[model samples]
Target: MKLRNLPPLALAAAVGVALTACSPSEPEPEESAPESASPSAPPTSEAAPAAVLPTGEPQVLATGLDVPWSVAFLGETALISSRDDGDVLELLPDGGTRVIGTVDGVVHDGESGLLGLAVDDQGRLYAYSTGEDGNRIERYGFTGEPGSLALGTGETLLEGIPAASYHDGGRIAIGPDGMLYAATGDAGNPDDAQDLDSLGGKILRMTLDGAVPEDNPFAGSLVYSYGHRNPQGIAWAADGTMFAAEFGQNTWDELNIVEPGGNYGWPEVEGIAEEGDFIDPVQQWSPEEASPSGIAVVEGTVFIANLRGEVLRAVPVADPGTATEYYAGEFGRIRAVTASPGGDLWFTTSNTDGRGDPSGDDDRLVGVEVG
Candidate 1:
């Protein structure tokens, strides 16, 4: 069922309290060295200016969605997945919506529900959802004909991934090699992040049919990398460099340059591990500043959707240390961000998801000219 109009104040109030109380805690401060004693620091080479991001007000594309989580393009239209409900909706060009189909057996709870959606080169649709067995991925055929847009019965591509009310990492994407890649959480078990045998807290690389790719770092295993807490965003640059955004415990959130079999220090270390086998995040943010969710890469820049920060962050792929925040607190808890076929950036708000204060026109999909 479509969700329209703001929920009752009582209901909204109760939900907001619960969500706020359960939100991730602020990160602890790290120790650092003192500043140089020299009267004047050495001059450094000037860096290039950041690329211009989309400006002006965002055009609302579709509204009245029930916790839209992920968006994928299907020809000219875009397909959106609702997290609380199993509905897969089509965002039409005229700013209308249509229920293409709903996934079966989705277990909607706290943070576990229908999550990520991806479209392959062959027009096949892949979705990640929490189910009775566990977190799973399903592949379906899509028919995009006008007035007949629909999704067929899904075939389970992968299953048995860990699931929990929180930390159910459920972002799926098609990599440059045409293989399917999935990011999974630690299922609320910190130890799982360091376990190589478990699929939790790791990125899985597999064929479309769920078989482990031969070139995978761990032969015959789906684990691409280990020691991830709860990664929710993954994107590839033009040069095929992969990047992922991860949630931290009570410390730094991370944006990492994903490498094959790379170990991202999690429970052992939150953000940067100055000296260890673990790789440091290319960029890190305080949990309060960035509960980063969905991300998109456009023209060598990474656009990150911040849940708590309520903003869109643009980080240059060449120099990730330089990040600029945009649309701060104007949209109310941005959840999903995707690059449109026309090179614009499309993002969805999560205000009506029982977390943030819902505006009159909330839970919407908005477009901004990024190109």
Candidate 2:
């Protein structure tokens, strides 16, 4: 389920009150999360549930999760996911979960929490989360608690991502050139969508350590592309071109090619054929068809996870930047999806947190073998 709150974030008020009432000083950051390899990634409290995959499934590689948010393959047999609350779990193909510990102090208000996640080529796990301050990306060692990873001190990989009740941009991924690309939301400020200085409402490319890559569209800056309302999902095909999925205000949602310095009109434009120097969406849809979130391009197919639509929509990408939808309506409140090693795809459902009533299970992790 998604969390909803008022626009512009009442965080300053809420945080100030919390601080004055609690600790007056800046809160100490959490220690790195510790990793565990006990076969599964679930908290020890719940017993493993039965594995559930499509009937003609690829042998249901695994199952039994506690609100799995984002899934990324660790090796040939294991993967990792984050619980909506704060717990991170490492799942095994045998349907078992091991609690890898929690990312402490993640303000789980509304549509925020442990949202977007990625494990880079270096085997480092990166998580874009809602900290007490706002939204940020933190990197971790592949196997431990938040503090145990390389950036164990919770070093800010990227900071100042806009986080609101409903439209917090949370997805992030490492591109082929070793730069970290992130999708961000407008934080309910339409004007902010056009502001390059504000980190909200844009796609940013930065170094793994949060530093601006030298060759970024804007020199010494992180903004790779701008003009987005709530760009939540990002993906890249084999050729290294980038594409992003955006949430619309009311008119239409969009899928756009993320070009360097490109502005895909927001506030200024909503759906189709808008004027000005803005790039239009390659495809558009009503919110019911694609309240899209996490995205993964597997074997030329863009797998987009829809939060409201409750489906996994696939768009085939023959050219790196262009695509056309091929499959839709196959999942339920899918919040996160990713391509696993060896050509399999993993997706998570979001029915428990507060959306539609989960099918008794609330949330789940399913594997898809894409063509």
Candidate 3:
């Protein structure tokens, strides 16, 4: 389809500056400041300086995409996955899109369809999608370079993940340890979060070939952590610390530092309980202000994309207790965000995902530089 890209730096100079909220109350490490999480006062940390915030407005890289979900880089080239039709699109130099290939057997409705995409260091492409059988992850072989890209038949890596209209955790990433980590929701049943035998409500890890690693916490299993409600975002700090964002029922949402075999207290608790029964989130917020979806760690900062809150948030790694918000309500709903190969931050909007208001220029892929 024909899409348009505005001049790279045009938007920043042409439009007025966006409002940025860089509030850091406690400066303590967010992992230790769960007590500060509340609707009136979010965890505060000023470790991230104002200089790290994005400079100027985000420029539209490509517009007119239909319900785009995830972004992956095959070198400098950007590939986007469509959540509605399961098609993979490659961005051209001229700002248009070419269909690389369509994922077959993807069943779409509600929050299900083709959701996440990842490219391994060896050039293999991985995707997470929903099907009649359930949710599954498939690996595909890639041939050719940017602009002339091609995807071979998909090989199902793992299948039978619990799926539902909501809580179908679909984010997948290849960790620094070269293992595949996947986030799965409770699939509408909170009890499943406590069931070790079920894959739902846990972050599962395995080899690239889909076999459970011998060193996994549970013997002969893929469950990395348990007791999660609807975790959709996962990332890692440079020091090898793992972080995740989870959606709470109605009271609070969470950001947690993940540990192997750790229990995150979903049905038993929502936020910081000061109890030892389960792991508490480092920071928590009301669902009305945060529906944190996709997150990426960049240059010591964690950037998050929120669906219901309609903002792109930044959390400093040094003191996660603090947060800086950008583009609040300026763009409809942000679904995906990642660091581009060229060192810029790229994100997508979710207006066409049925939960947001869509404009003629909605569902765009935008790129911006983070100072």
Alpha-carbon RMSD to native, per candidate: 8.6, 16.2, 5.8
**Candidate 3: tens digits of C-alpha lDDT, residues 1-371:** 11122234444333321212222221121222345552233333444333255654456677788999999988778889999899999987655788899898999979899989999998889999999999999999877777899899899999999999889888899998999999999989999999999999999999999999999999999999999999889998776778898888998888888899999998898887767889877777778778999998887788888889888888777666567777778678998998887667889999999999987767888776776
**What lDDT score belongs to each candidate, Candidate 1 first?**
0.80, 0.64, 0.81
Write one digit per residue (lDDT tens) for candidate 2, span 1-371. Answer: 00021111232232221112223332222221112111121121123222122112322233445566677644443445554677766653235566665676787777788876677767777787888788888877754533232223455676667777767787788788888888888877778779999898888898888898888989887899988998878887666657788899876888776789998898788766546588777677778756877888775567778877666666545422222332233335777777666556667766676775655433666554443
Give the Å shift of residue 51 in candidate 1.
3.7
| TM-score of model 1 vs. true structure | 0.86
Question: Which residue pairs clash in candidate 1?
Answer: 185-201
Candidate ranking (TM-score, best to worst):
3, 1, 2
lDDT of 1 by residue, 209-314 (tens): 9999889998889999889999999998777778899999887888888989999987788887664688888778788878999999887678899998787888
Error of 1 at 356 (Å): 1.3
Residue 371 local lDDT, model 1: 39
Tell me which residue pairs clash in candidate 3.
43-321, 44-321, 44-322, 45-321, 45-322
lDDT of 1: 0.80
- Model 3 regions more than 4 Å off: 1-35, 38-51
